[model samples]
Target: MGVVSVKKSVVLLSLGHACVDVYQGAVAALVPFFIAERAYSHAAVAGVVLAASLLSSVAQPLFGAVTDRRALPWLLPVSTIVGGVGIALSGVSGSYAVTLAFVAVSGIGVAAYHPESARVARIASRGSHTAMSWFSLGGNVGFALAPLLVTAVVATGGLRFTPLLVLPALAGSVLCLPVLRGLAASAANGSVAAQAKRPDDRGSFVKLSIAVVGRSITFVGLSTFIAVYAQERVGGGVLAGTIALFTLYVGGAVGTILGGRLANRWDRVTVVRYAYLVAVVAVAGVVFVPGPAFYLFVAATSAGLYVPFSLQVTLGQDYLPSRVGTASGITLGLTITIGGLASPLIGGLADATSLRVALAPLIAMPVLSWLMFRTLPEPAVMGADGSDGRQPAPDVGHRGAVAVGVDAPGQVGDGDARQRS
Candidate 1:
């Protein structure tokens, strides 16, 4: 494939990624509407969020494991449609049980879409951190847009108009066609080579996963309640909440791009560790700061948490070269969604006490993340051809040695290499 074609494929994949994640963001965006329309308690609405994540979390790793053994590009479009359909139907019925079920169905679609999409994105990106960041930025944009989209559609027409929410999914599914065709053409031409097998670094990946879980809990916790919390802090009603949520998510777009640039200069582990340190301070500010200043802190927290977002996905893949699918699934899917598991607990606490108090505990999550990252070693960088590449000089303050590189077993020319310093 030519450079133009590769860039086009990556762009389309990123758009498709945006479409699918709209539903993921929409789930949170819909929380306020659910409360207003149904008079559901904090815990009750949190259960709805739980439904969206519970099934997805369990199914993501399974899907990744399956894709590890077989490439399922078709899942991209199919899952996109399924995810949209579930969310589209979620608010149509008033039955709480039915809503939960539909949301769970959406979760399944989301779970199915991520592992394969990550694989495709990695291939299309050719192992460039900037390219992968753009792919991740698409999802962040989707998340940022969800509030505005949901508020526009459902706020004016109420939850019954949720069918309109399916538009992005349909659009996303169509977007997948050209990219899939391009991939097929590349495969037919044998431009895609088989990956050389390498050993998996299970220990580093475990530590990385734990750090991701911490970040996840912090991010998901904030995303779930930041809107409502904003209202409590500022008094602009729904508009205040929407703006806050947007600020939080939009900051992530900035962070993803910034992370890519930073990774090009420093090893990913160092970048991630420092980002978490920033997060620890930023999260505290978000919790205690008053008035519109709260928005600034929210943005800081989002940016700090997200600066390592794409880097972590690539790091997980590098740490487990032999299980890219599983790594992608865990980094991009399982561990990320696992944060949702805490939503109910947060909601229950909010119900028993207050949103502020419930969220206060989140301040420590990034601290734990920083601690985990402190112990992680940077994996060996791979070349564009899937061979071990020259190691860059160690970054200042980096403690762990860069591990020796190995050619992992997989399709070669998939762009699994880090940028050369």
Candidate 2:
């Protein structure tokens, strides 16, 4: 049993997410530049993004089902090839039709990654916040770095090479193969089943799934449009344009770390409520900030934004300790469709009312999220480990208790800090 732990599993998954985010989000930042280079319309770029989201958000559940039923170590790698080829093709795409087609293809690669990876994280992490935090950070860092990396590539080698840049990550994401093989080893040896199990593993985990979708809608809104909002609504410079990304993700990274510690100290629900309230405040501040201090307010608006992102994923694992793959797909998969489906409408609203109009959901979504969370049964996972009156997970020991913290059988020393949780 000294082999894989949830912590190790999540760390690998986190790294994978970083690679995928760069693959999927590079064009989001590059769209305006693409339009300038190709004379495309704002609406046309939005359409391309919309196409990617449709593939990503809608197709995820199907992929999630595949991950659960099958054990293809090459799934992530194969998808990366498709996505990388599609992205590289985007710059060279001759027509709008071709561009959208390539974008959608890349989105498919982007879409398949999360559910599969999240399932891995959940299994490896053993059902703990630390595991979820690592996953969140991996994805956050990946998404956050997309614009920077893509822009640098575009600047140095030009847009044509943009697709080529994703090749490394595209290739590297396949590392999951070895990891999956290791997991099979553990399962075959009975270490996994013996070490871990959760009560909710056999159930639907539906409520947790709903909460995940709600948070994703808001998270994607900021990730997808905060830059445009920064430039247009807040009047910030292009550099300051990532205000939401910077404030939300970096702060959420910090908050998630703290949340892990706090979950150990306070109730998980308490920390979640506080995090959601902060999101409500942050979104509102962005929506109705007064003149002048737009930068200051946008930064503040981003505060606490990603906390729920980390929280919801962790919470889902806690809710359905065994169904991490479903929870992962539920959290990230439905997002491809539900929140993604809202993009064109959101863009259309931004077009009609003003760029600031896009900020509408960014602000209101959290309040609605809070309302949804309120209806949820109090999370028992917070007091897990025999800490809060509940029995230790029936057959699962600390391994089962620490659901998201499992390290996997082979990669024992990746030096990931989130695992210390």
Candidate 3:
């Protein structure tokens, strides 16, 4: 009534952007730009980015599992420190080998993020489903905003200013120190408490996992390589083509907000399933569309398909009540890594045939994603809290551990159980 009570939502969004800034600018979007600026081959760019995705994705699940048992409040600041350093160094890298190393180290920082951030949202919010929708929207926004930031700097300051570009990230990192300290202190004092225990959904999880992995081949293919695609295949200036990638981001931004709204009002699965149908059309259209007219439809594909990302993350968070950290990490990390891995193969196909010819697999991904999601039970039918169509929260009283705040694992140290183990 007095002031809008969206503190939790704000915090979630900020964290999302923090995660986004760490990767999109320095890793994903940077790959091709670096190739052009540094004069490297397309395959080499794919390989370096592959290193990034693999490390980040693999690390997320492992770290998420760790956070489940122990809360470490300092991870936020520490991760920012590592991420900032890696990014700053990357901007200055003179050789492809060194750049690859920089991206790999930066990947570690990004890898540390999802598990803790997702877990925090679950443990902190009363409505994890709705919260995750907004939570994921934050990340979506950040990804959308990255190119603008890159364009602004490169436009005004030129590529030389890139190395010093770590300043903003460093500032963001330093600013989080107080926030992380408070989280740690609260966890240490036992001020935060565990969420209600929930049943795990083995079968639904498997199905969703397959769906996301399938979808990722398309999502990553588009996200990672779209800018380059425009330059080479779309018959536009590099700057124009670069801006074209922003169309996808524009679509994605809308999709994130729209996806959240859909999750709040309807079935998350319905929204996600529909996104695939749009993606299939978009991928095909993008491949065949000629000249400037093609950009408009590509933008449509981006908007229609990207909106469901939040839905996917929310579903995963809801499904794994006891393991939000691990689930978030895997959902994001593994799925996108699949795309990252497959992109090189796509690039090779383009090398042999053509860029348009290599992208055929992208159309298939959504179909597979949709089919896999359909087999799982509807979230509402299974008493899902807007998660994977899985079991509901277990009785809270039965669990032995008591977690506090968002950092139930080590990001925030949980208090020692008052009762004996």
Best by lDDT: 1
Local distance difference test scores for all models: 0.81, 0.59, 0.61
- Compared with the true structure, the alpha-carbon lDDT of candidate 1 equals 0.81
User: lDDT at 237 for candidate 2?
Assistant: 62
> Candidate 3 on 349-378: residue-level lDDT in tens?
767787778776788887888898777665
Candidate ranking (lDDT, best to worst): 1, 3, 2
lDDT of 3 at 200: 65
Q: Mind giving the per-residue lDDT tens digits that candidate 1 earns over 1-421?
A: 4323768877898899899999999988999999999998899888998999898988988887766656677999999999999999999999999999999999999999998788777766767788889999999998889999999999999999999999999999999888776655555443323333456799999999999999988988888888899999887999999998888888999999999889888888899899999999999998889897898899999899999999998888777765667778888774458778999999999999999999999999999999999999888864545457533211100011111011222333222221110
* TM-score for each predicted model, relative to the true structure: 0.92, 0.80, 0.84
- Greater lDDT among 1 and 2 belongs to 1
Give the range where candidate 2 is weakest over 10 consecutive residues by summed lDDT: 412-421
Per-residue lDDT tens digits for candidate 2, residues 1-421, read 1344545556666777677767655657666566557876546667777777786776776775454444334666677666767777877755789888988888888777776566555445644565667776776676667777766777666667666666656545665655655555554443222222447732325755665566666766665666666666556566656544455445555665666666656656567667777777767776667454655555444445555566665565456554444555666665444665666666677667775666676676667666666666544532323454321122221223222222342222212111111
